[model samples]
Target: QPQNVIEKIVQRYAVNLPTPSHKVAQGDFVSIQPEHVMTHDNTAAVMSKFQSIGAARFNNPQQAVFTLDHDVQNKSEKNLTKYRSIAAFAQSHGVDFYPAGRGIGHQILIEEGYAFPYVMTVASDSHSNMYGGIGALGTPIVRTDAAAIWATGRTWWQIPPVANVKLLNTLPEGVTGKDIIVALCGLFNNDEVLNTAIEFTGKEGIAALSVDERLTIANMTTEWGALAGVFPVDEVTIKWLRDRAVYLARTQNRKHERINDERIQDLVRNPLLSDSDANYAKHLTLDLATLTPHVSGPNSVKHATPLTTLEQQRIKINKAYLLSCVNSRASDLRAAANVLKGRKVADGVEFYIAAASSEVQKDVEKSGDWDTLLRAGARPLPAGCGPCIGLGVGLLQDGEVGISATNRNSKGRMGAPTAQAYLSSPAVVAASAVSGYICGPQSLHPTNPISKTFAAFHAHPQSPIITYTDNATQTPPAKSAPADVIPGFDGTLRGEILFCDADNLNTDGIYPGKYTYQDDMSPERMAQVAMENYDPGFTKVAKKVRVNDILISGFNFGTGSSREQAATALLYAGFRAVLAGSFSETFKRNAINNGLIVLEAPQLVSDLRKAFKGGEEVLTRRTGWDATVDLVGGSVGVGERRYKVPPVGRAAQELIVEGGLENWVKNRIAA
Candidate 1:
């Protein structure tokens, strides 16, 4: 019974059940109590949900962390009041809290040692995958999932399938980890690793990548459609822990006993690695030496172009950014400074820079990288998620073409939907800013490009091979009270269909970023702006259709951001269910937690598109195509065509039937 790194870490945190075997494998729904649950500005929304669930005190206060970083630059009384309220809540609950400008929550978690090796951490952010860089098993959960953890200290999660990605050779000078991930996303755009966990191997190549580089690569795996991208805990990881411990002790004047060398050595002695015979759904080998500086957007992460091509295209840029949880560490700042050493930004271009955390900012300032960037005419923003989440200053204006070192460039995420954004490494971004267009650092500095080869293969999915123990008599944990009776699900839903044929319908398109931090938004207000970014006529279509009509979309619906409001907005807009070719895992969980029905039927979606004769409009208002979804029967009926769909598990059905996990947890607490 060989287990991969992800499986091994999951088993360590999995709650024991009364079964013949305690071992866990891929696709098994196991209850887990994670070491930490992080929420940033979204903490306010989670707090509301927690209170709604009748939770007076945290089940494990110390395990929770609240950070205010998303909208740190916002000084509006409303925003400040919300921040104050979050601080008050954290203090009252005895939970760790970081105020605005402290740093992005994800980076703060790493800086403070909350996300350690082999630890299971979940955050209310898609970028939580970044923690996997440090050998931790980190994943994203919806706001409801966060609230559930607060109420009960445990929640159910299905172990995703794993993929093995082996890196060979060392990276070229100009090509950073951001380029490596961007190249992967662009080259493997066909849902190759969608919804799968990834394990990076190849000891020599892993050793060559700095911790900052590893963090950047792992952070963008969210954009690459993977659930997690984990690196092995080798000497590189151990050294980082030791260095961090020393830095903490020297700067904060406090000893961090848990992160000392002895503990780190013990961890390395029992390093977590996939067994030799562990099964992987897919395998990819990358030659890092062959990698070139790449840019991945203009709107989509899947549209990757080598920097040479962009330089040839002479794509002019009006704005440039080097900030986000992904890049903006001290190393990234140094790279940017190296490119902008004695140059100035183009006359018409505006370049903005922000560090990942205040601690990182201090480090760069001490190293003179911060001064070099400022002297190069880069505007300094607060050490937070400035302009990355479409907040604060430096948002792209209409018709602006911008390049960024951030992880995502989805439409309307950083600014105007009509504006275009391209993604690149920090060096490339700085170079582009100086050149007044998109270009790599190589354009300014001479370097020879390396040529190399690699191999990859997709293995057939394998069934889990579990070894059972003879301990069937093990008792499960006792329930505090009897569970209240929840209404039964009929397994049938009927609704008219509203079709949106666009693929990659990101969360930003579903719910605009402007309203994301408005914690006091009512359902009516949410419905009014539902899909406004994607299609302005969406509300009109919703009004014309029946109240419980189903919303249908193309592939990868709800693909960007971990904002649960994306699902809730649709729910409040009267969509009884969402039928799509596929869904983002985070969005699926959010929909399920909010009791919104979600079904996947790719062929059926294509057929419906043909039946409606809908064009390429973002949203189509059709007259017919009524659908009846049968979850238990595992089929969907639209007109006379019957389409097969996977059956929903009982646990998920129970959550939907009970009007979400909040009600389920409430009933359990009451019982």
Candidate 2:
């Protein structure tokens, strides 16, 4: 049971445990502790529905949380309606709703006492697994689970077979958490072990990373089809948490009550580690000493290759972006800024910087390091799911190229369908910003980099003024921006109903099985499930393969799960776009990231009831736009229209072609 011994033991006993099944029901199942179960503004829409259906309090409010980090600055009545209502819901139901400006969800969760070691958690959002930094299990759940959890605090889940990641030594210079994960994406991408648990241990783990760095690797577990990620939270973790508490007490709300210390004294004051005898489904040690700057993605996150493996001379980066819950830590920002401190961004490349937490942003701004980045030609943007999501900066245009600090670089994820994205660390993003192509962190950032935390992010570029919506009334979908129009194609339209319609949909609804073990992203298999999962009739209605389909909705559509696979499933189903009454922030961004159009169609539900006559051709405002239908009765739309519905920039369009960052890197290497 010693740390080194666990690896060999797990390897020998792997076959005895559940040998990587996508789905399993445990009769003698141990109650795997919930790592996390979260909801944010996005999932609040579904909660509204749950309430309407006569659902009252959640079974266990302590297990639930709500964060208003998004759209919080707007004092508008509509925004306030949604934000305030969710807050009220949390207050009424005894759930936690972190105040706006508290920073992103996962960051706050760790700072405010939620995530810890040896626990399993699922969220309505994808990145919830970030808690793995503290050795917790984190997973993204679909809308089906969302509803069930909304009514009842618990939902069913099969304990994922574990994947042991053995770390043998310290990380190499300029190599980091980002490289480790991207490398794994390439190394363990086969279907044999998808949707597994990844546990890291060894002297290598002890030496290489800080708790924050571990979170970076943990955040992207979803891309690996992981149920959650875990690392032993040691003294280092406990210290960071306590220091953070002090940091927050002084810098944030001075009056804010510290986490109830008495109740969590052991966790905050002295956290424990996983026993050497701990069980694992699988174990694979990584030689962190050998790791180097690597990049991933021209298509799936699985498309990973070493920096040396890539044909760097042929690659051109149109954009260099730094953002994400993972790498946006202050250490990363300073590393990136230091690299670009005196250098200008490449001539043709657009540069962007995004921080994950407002505190981190404040730290950077207070130090004025942010000014160094801006002076270096990188446009400083507020922290949110930036280029990582389609809504913010670094949007890849069709055939455009980009380098980013995000966790996943899945195809079209930056924006443009043909665009390509490369995933790397902050130092790598900085290096790429200077060189105008994918480059290693060492090329720009040096060893023992200097970092500046505790600056004023809000006062500088001014991160988005988070506006809270006090009410969760369905925001009727409407074209929030003008879209681009393309000439109609000569191909036959797939089905009479270009899309389908429904109310209160989530990404999980669009793609039911993303978290399943197979981790299948195949076009045929995914399209097969698109509408079928919701309404069996969707399979046939979506069958007309030649034409684009559209799906319309009534209200609060696409409410749960940040899985881009949701949009991918719809795209593969021959749907061009999603025309909905409203979309959850994450799902809406996922639509744009995958190159599918998601436009506001408040009027579609009314006019389309009769207009959806089976014989009618459902062409929309955007030609490439596609959608699908739920036979039980619903419609969907995808693709661009006259309105620029939360779009990615020209640079981002270039990254989408490879389907994501890993594939982009692979393609870059091949070329």
Candidate 3:
């Protein structure tokens, strides 16, 4: 545990004695303590299960933070009722809660000082990795495990193998972090970082970036299929925090406090640098000089194309959004605002700007960017996660195309299933808003680099109007250990194979976030729509199947978002196991925690794909293929031919046998 930042942090909070191998490498199971656990609107659904288990009260309510973000506006009476239930739960439980309009949970963590270096926090959102920019271990977990954290201050974690991404040189003007991450996705193709922890190194390259820029890189790490994205805490981080503190004091009209060099330094652990002799599973070098404005188009973040060539493709769009945790910081907003200044949006284009937080929103108003954007016909949305989860305005119509700053452009992700969405930097999105098509920032102004104007726009941005309140006491909560269960695979599992292709099937494709507001929802209700976007008739197939039915998919299966409901819905739909080439770290965890086993069967998956005529190209035309999964023998069967299935590991196997983490904990506590 000496060489890597992840191992060091894990060792500090780990409840079990560390194994010798865990010291240098990864893939070891350990239980660790989380400083805080964050949940959003999904808390209501999780609380239902927590209560069903007869847990009297949350063990440490102060460490639990809940926010109303996903369905902030409550489009229906059912949605409103769910919000009321969430509010009631927070009030009655004595936990900290942020109501609607409070901004995205990730933004709230930074502005409110909840995230810090060496801190181990977990959120239900996959973008929880966004906090890794500040050097915290903010990993994603399922809602069921989140509920377990409410009862016990600790949870189990598998120490992921580490990889290092070294930025070789500083990025030139006009090229931003968004471009760097998109390039990485295109290069690595999602599967490379599956279940791996990525530490971005190179002090010179990282130091050149602003805090917002660093955050943008970390935010998209989830899209790269990484377990977490970490940037070392340094002088730049210290300065950003101090400046933010000063801004908060000025806007809140309070005495200068809450942030200082000494206080910030105390939060970090000793030996901040990764050990010189540390081992890395993989090492990659990225030269920023080669980077340019890039955009990921139509259906996947991995399908990136350089913006210089986008015009030749003539990709006109109906909407452009400059928002989301990926690019909604003050610096990011200013860069976009500078592009929109004195320029009108194209006649048919709908431009939308949403500040990541109320603090950023206030900064936009103070800097006069709000008026500038309004004059350019950009609609200023509320400060929550507006339209990122397809919750608010800017949902695309059928066959419409939208270019957005938000991460993940999976099909049916933003609006109608047939709508096409693309991802890019806010500056590119702002310029595209004007051109009514995909274009780079250089297209906006022939004479100026976009970076040159960011400072001028950033000049007036500062201060939050809200007051900070500390609910958690200085004393750490006493640990409540979960029962040690190490169960093995017990029986034969057979099912029809549900074929899904690799490289970009996200959680949204599994269980769409847009239907989160539907009334009287249940596992069955969700099952009907499970994988509807990917395979239109999957629900019908699932309904006709018996228990232990299987789903076979290509690489990076379940690659986007961290909605536990994705696993829950599939389980309800009668899927007992998912055999795929690989899976996103969060999705794999969610599936296991819910008792739906996820087996890594690379060859079986490849053969499953080849069973069809055009292979992956014909994924949409998939009909059911039968496969018998023999977990007891560590292999799967298709027409009497057996192929090895990757071991589920002792910890994951234990959880699967116990019917998920919830059942394991429930039975242990009862015993």
TM-score against native, each model: 0.78, 0.61, 0.76
The sequence of per-residue lDDT tens digits that candidate 2 reaches over residues 421-532 is: 8887787678778877776544443432422211111112211111112111333212112112223312122333344556666566667754434664567888888754
Question: Which candidate leads in TM-score?
Answer: 1
Sorted on lDDT, best first, the list reads 1, 3, 2
Name the runs in model 2 displaced over 4 angstroms.
1-36, 60-62, 69-81, 91-94, 99-101, 144-147, 249-279, 309-311, 441-671
Tell me the number of clashing residue pairs for each predicted model: 1, 136, 2
Which pairs clash inside model 3? 1-23, 247-463
- Top-lDDT structure, candidate number: 1
lDDT (Cα atoms) of all candidates against the true structure: 0.82, 0.59, 0.75
Model 2 C-alpha lDDT versus the unseen true structure: 0.59
Tens-place lDDT digits, model 3, residues 414-499: 89889999999888898889888887655665544554533332333221111111111232211112223354665567666766
lDDT of 1 by residue, 1-671 (tens): 67888988988887743343555666555568899999999999999989988989898998899999999999999999999999999999999999998999999998888889999999988899999999988999878889989988977676776778888878755467887899888877778778888898888888999899899999999998998999988888888898888888887788875566677777967878778877676777777766766789889999988776677789999999999999999999998998788789989999999999988998999999999999999999998997998998999999999999999999988999999999998888998999898987656543313111101101121111111111112422111111122258666778887788888999999999999999999999999999999999888878776766788899889987778899999888888789898888978888878888777777888786776674644465664777887766567887788886655545556677778788878987887
Better of 1 and 2 by lDDT: 1
Poorest 10 consecutive residues of model 2 by lDDT?
463-472
Better of 1 and 3 by lDDT: 1
Model 2 root-mean-square deviation:
18.7
Which residue pairs clash in candidate 1? 481-671
Provide the global lDDT of candidate 1 against the true structure: 0.82
